[model samples]
Structures are given as C-alpha cells and as structure tokens.
Target: MKITTIETFVLGERQLLVRIGTDVGLAGWGDATLEHRPGTVAAAIREMSGHLIGTDPLPVTRHWQRLARGGFYRGGPVLGSAVAGLDIALWDLRGRFYGAPIHELLGGPCRDRVRLYTHALSARPEHTGEPDRARALVAAGYTLVKAAISGPVGFLDSPRQTARFVRDLEALREAVGDEADFGIDLHGRVSPHHARRLADAVAHTGPAFLEEPLRPEHSRLIGQLTATTSIPIATGERLYSREEFLPVLQAGIAIAQPDLAHAGGITEVFRIATLAESFDVQVAPHCPLGPVALAACVQVDLAVPNFYAQEHVIDLRSADSRDLRLLTGPEVLVPVAGHLDRPTGPGLGIEIDEDAVRAAHRDDLLVPRGTPRWSHPDGGFAEW
Candidate 1:
C-alpha cells in the first residue's frame, strides 16, 4: 500500500510520535523523540516525507536507504532520529500488513524472553537514596539496575568527589548484595584522566559495566580505559549508525547500547547488533523513550542472537504509569521477573491508544522536557 500521508505528534514530555497512513487504511506509529530536540526531529521527519508520500511502505530497507543515505548531508542525530521514526513506522506497517511481528520478519525469535534493565537513584551524585532505590528495584524483580554519576565533574576533581562517587556505587552494591547486577553510567561527563581514575576506584565494586566512561568524541581512547578495567564498557546512545559503531566495537567495548529511537530504528540497530556479534560484543539497545521505542527495541532484542539486556525507563512494576498510559496493551510489554516474553501481536506488538495519544497532545501535559543545564562553582558550563 502506498503511504498516503505522514504526520507527527509532539506529545507531552519531549516525545515526538510519527504516524504514517497507508492508502489501504492501515496506519503505523513510531517514536522519533530526540530528548531536547523533538521539534527539530519533527521538522526533519516532515522534510523527509517529501520522498515518502505516495510511495510503497513495504520495501522498508529500500526506503531507509533512500531517506537515510539520499540526503547529501546525512546521518547526525537529527536526520538519524527522523529516519529512525519513519523506518520504525514503516516496519510496523509492514509487520501488520504481513500479519506477523517485526522480529518474525527479521528471522523469528532467538530467545523466549528478553532481559531488561532499569535505572535506580537520581543522576545527581549527592542523592542519598541509591541504596533505597536499588533495593526497591530489586524488590520489583529487576536483577539489573543502572545509575548515573553525579551531574558534572572537572578535569581533575578533588579526591573527596571521587571518593563520594565510589561510595555511591558501593552503597548500591551493598543494598542488593549479590542478588542483582548494577552498572555505573558516567553519562559521558567525565574527562579521560578522571574517567580512568573513577574506573580504577570503582573496579573493586564489580559493576556490571561502565557506561560512556568518556564522551563519544573521546571514543578513540576507550580501548585504553577498557584494558585498564575488567568491567564491561558500554556506550553508543549518541551514536547513530553501524559505521559509527565499528570503531568503538574495535575499541573493546563489551556491550553496544544503540538507542533504537535515535540509531536508525530496527533496521540499523539489528545491523549494529550483527556487527557487534562479529566482535563477540553483546547488544543492549538503549531505550528510555516511550512504549513505541521500547517495543521496537524488544523486537530487535528477540531477533539478535548476541542480545544482552534492554535498557528502559518504563516502570514495569507499575500497573499504570506515564509510560503505560499511552498504550492500549501494556501487558504485551510488562516484564515478568525482569524479562519480557515474546509477543504474538502483529507489528510492534503493543497497540497505541490513539485517544490517549491525542489527549496527551491536546492537553499539553508532557511539559516539553529537555536536558537540564549545569555550571561549575566557578561559573563555567558543565555537562548535565
């Protein structure tokens, strides 16, 4: 069926959802949220729609190549995220048209259930609730939890700051003991020297991994840091393509964390997973957006043989929450004992609650969230 129209919805809470209507009355939805830049991504999606209107939505990959590579200046977060939403929508449409899930279209399931991980504690380093939060997550049946480091650090912070960061992780470990695995998310806010220092200091805690120990720009130095620590290094929420992932995979990352919503959606993330598999690295798609993005990630997690844990912000323990409010079939995604089972429904498996989506948009309830800004004591801008 030809794509009759493409529309974008700026839902509350910094979400951008795209709906592609087919001539045959089938419509597919996908999340194109880019955190602080949903509006810009929406504009990009509208711009790319010029090539998609009145075209076949079945040859998903061909369209991906045309939209993703056809542009003379292509493949940054904006274009990548725009293409990602459209690609995911096209996949959803194709899956529904074929009466199969996206994973089945890829090659059937590789595992019965996909393991998932959620965050614990506030990103603020000084937050004192890590242990309590960790215990709460463990009680909720999540065996893996990740927490970010304190907001910002200088090139060489004091020994006191370093020790505080270490202590925070130590507290989390103590709370869960050996019952669960915890990861340290540096959030690409540390300098190289301090990243190694923090990595060295926390090595004794035995975290599941060190996520984004250094920014993507410093990926060339990742190998050095990986060699210095036994903890698995995971990054790539900012990376958009397989070519961008190759260098970091070569740098000895143990896990690749491509955000399905931002990294070319199911098509590119599956390819990234395959590339990581060749290097003996595992795939744990980075998804902190809405249900559509999580559903897309689950489909990939089920299809890829080298799949690792999936990252999500969904409160799986909650029967009803903001993440679940937008979906009609949240049960299809809720994890049982920290693992999501295979879905039998077509497309992304969970159906969007169109009324709820429209209400969220109409009421402007999502608050248009963006990344918070931070500055050091001396008044210089710091990573947030």
Candidate 2:
C-alpha cells in the first residue's frame, strides 16, 4: 500500500507521537519526543513528512537514506530525532504487515532477554550516599546501576571537592562489593585535568564504565583519558549520527551509548550498532525517555549481537504507569530479576494509550525554563 498522510501529535507534556497513515488502513506509530525540544523536533518531523507522503513503507532502508542524506545538511538532534520516530513507525508497519516481530526481520534473536541498568539521581549526596542505594538496587534486582558522582566541578576547585567525590565512590564499591557492576557519570562537568585526576582516584573502584567525563566537543580527549585509566569510557548521548561516533569508536573507546530517540531511531541505530561492532565496540542504547522509546531500544537490543546493556529511567515507569500499561504483549520489556525479556509481539510490541497520552499533554508538564543552575565552588557552570 502507498503512504497517504502523516500526522504529528504532542501528547503527555513531552511525548511526541507520529502517525503514518497508509492506503491499506495500516497505520504506524512512533515516538519522536525530545526532553525539552519536542516542539522543534515535531516540526522537523512534519517537514520530513513531505518526503514520505506517497512512498512505500516497505523499503525502509531507501526511505532512511532519503531522509538522512536527501538533505544537503543532515544529521543533527532535530533531524535525527525526527527521522528516528518515522523510522520506528515504518519498521512497526513492516513487522505488522509481515505478521512478525522486528527482531525476526533483523535475523532473529541473539539472546532470549536483554539486561538493563537503572539510573540513580541523588538530591543530597549524604542522604542518598552510594553505599546505601547500591545495596537497595542490588536487592531490588539490578546487577547494574549508574550513579552521578560529581555534581559539577569547577575549573579550579579545591582538593577537598576531589576527595569528596572519591570518598562517595569508595562507599559505593564497599556497598556493592565486587559482584555488582556500577558506572560513574561525570556528566561532562570536569575539565581535562580534573577528569584525569578523578579517573586516577577512582581507578580501583572498577566502574563498569566512566561516562561523559569531558564535554562532547572535547571528544578527542577521550583517547587521552582512556589511555590514562583502565576504566571503559562511555559517551555519545549528545552525539547524533554515525559520523559523530567514528572518532569516538576509533579512539578505542569501549562503549558507544547512542540515545534511540535522539540518534536516528531504530533504522539509524541498527547501522550505528553494526558500525560499532565492526570496531569491536558495544552498544548500551541511551534511553531516559518514555515507554515507547524504551520499547524501541529493547527491539534493537534483541536483534543486535553487540548490544552491551540497556539504560532505563525507572522513575518514569513509576510516575506514568497509565502510559506504560499500554505495553500488554507477551514479549514486553518487563524487569525480571534485573533483566528484560525480548518482545515477541508484532511490530515494536508495545501499544499506545492514546487517551492517556493526550490527557497528560499540557504546557506546564514540559521541562521548565531556568530550572536550576549547578555551579562549581569557583563559580564555573557545571554540567547538569
């Protein structure tokens, strides 16, 4: 059937949905929501829809190329995110048309289940110290957990700040012991010098990986940091395309964490995973968004052989159960003993609660402006 129309919907405050209607009454749904840039991304989706209006949805690769390189200037957050939503919807449509899951089309399952890691954000470092929460996560069935250690480092901070960061990580290691794997996210707050120092201090902690120790633009520094520390360096949430990932991977970085929604959706991410695999790099699939995005990531996880693990924002699952309840398939990404089973249902395997999504759509629910500024002791703006 030929494509008929494309519609974009902004639901649940930050949820951006794309519906691609075909002549055969089969419609595809995708999530293109960016944390704070939903409006801009939605507009990009609408603009890209002009290219997809009358095309066949089956040639997914051709469509992806058209949307990606069709433009003279391609591959950024808005364009990549917009294409990501459409690519997922197209894949979902293809799966439904063939009466098989996306994983089957991608050469079947590599594993029965996909393991996941949870995000831990602490307001008060002392109140929610690493040791106390590490035990709780392990007990709650998580083999992997990521914690933000340094809030924001200044250009010229005291040795005391560095000591505190090291102490917290030590406490975490003590709580989890050697059995559990943990990751530390510097959040790109530390400079090259500080990053090197901090990496040295926490070298013995055996972090599964150290993430975004430096800013995205300073990616060349990753090679330096990787050389200095044995810990695996992980980054790329801010990065958009395969081109952006080339240097990072070539630098001998261990993990490539591409956000499913922000990267080029399932279509582009599948290519990204393949590229990383060629370089002997593993994928974690960065996803702190909603259920649809998580479902999309899990589908990729099942099909990709080089997938390392999945990152999830467990808080959203608790806060928006109604939206999450839409996932009622046998292969739903349910956390069982700290791991998620591969989805078996047709398409992306998760259904959308249109009513619930629309109900939660409000201007106030979006991330607020000027939320808070985190700074270092020397008045330098720190990464948040």
TM-score of each: 0.96, 0.92
129-150 in candidate 2: lDDT tens per residue? 4567778777877888888765
The Cα error of candidate 1 at residue 109, in Å, is 0.4
lDDT of each: 0.87, 0.80
Which residue ranges in model 1 land beyond 4 Å of their true spot?
123-125, 362-369
> Top model by lDDT, which number?
1
* Residue pairs in collision within model 1: 12-366, 13-366, 125-150
- Candidate 1 overall Cα lDDT vs. reference? 0.87
Clash-forming residue pairs, model 2: none
Which whole-number lDDT from 0 to 100 does residue 148 have in model 2? 75
Best by TM-score: 1
